[model samples]
Target: MSVASMLKNNKLSKAICEASWATFKAMIAYKAKWYGKQLVVVAKNFPSSQLCSHCGYQNKDVKHLTLREWQCPNCHTRHDRDVNASINIKNEAVWLLTAGTAGLAY
Candidate 1:
């Protein structure tokens, strides 16, 4: 087998991630359209990283994508690659929706 084909066959992680992410986002978008629900894409600059998942502490250091794992200097809490960021983003979305401020915030 050629190297290119070998790489394609062995790249399970990337393929799986791409497939799932695409499907999930598409499902949400299509369903929202079908139901006339508002679907907001939180602005790319919405600070998904700098906000601490645990304390809501905003710091500039957290935005560095190179640091997949890092310690929140303020709280001395270590976080996994995307876990803290995902949690913080989800919480923020819920908060904005529940607070009836999603229209103005996103």
Candidate 2:
């Protein structure tokens, strides 16, 4: 899903709109090209925040913003919401990069 679709009826939509995420993304894209690096944007609906970085578990019950810290039920690992989400996003981007090039001769 795209960011626009994911933002519909979402509280963060207003903040994101005010922040000009489109322009930010554009700038990142331009910088990546200039530096010969790739910018891999995960699908907007990806459950990065709900995913456990330690055990690859998805906690669907964590739907409230108030739940800022959570323990992975599978791994029993504690995680800070923002930190875990950032780790998950990085993992997802690395996976995407590797998967996309897995079939190449080089």
- Return the top candidate by TM-score: 2
Q: Which stretches of candidate 2 lie over 4 Å from their true place?
A: 1-19, 101-106
lDDT of 1 by residue, 1-105 (tens): 654565477566577667877788788878888887766555557777777777777768766788788777778778874898788777877887788777431
Off by over 4 Å in 1: 1-27, 33-40, 104-106
TM values, all candidates: 0.59, 0.75
Q: Local error of candidate 2 at 30, Å?
A: 0.5
How well does candidate 2 score on lDDT at residue 2? Answer: 73
Candidate 1 collision pairs = none
lDDT of each: 0.72, 0.82
lDDT tens digits, residue span 1-106, model 2: 7778757958778877867877788888888788887788888787998999988999987768899999989999998999999999889888878888422111
User: What number of backbone clashes does candidate 2 have, counting pairs of residues 3 or more apart or in separate chains?
Assistant: 0
Worst 10 residues of 2 by lDDT: 97-106
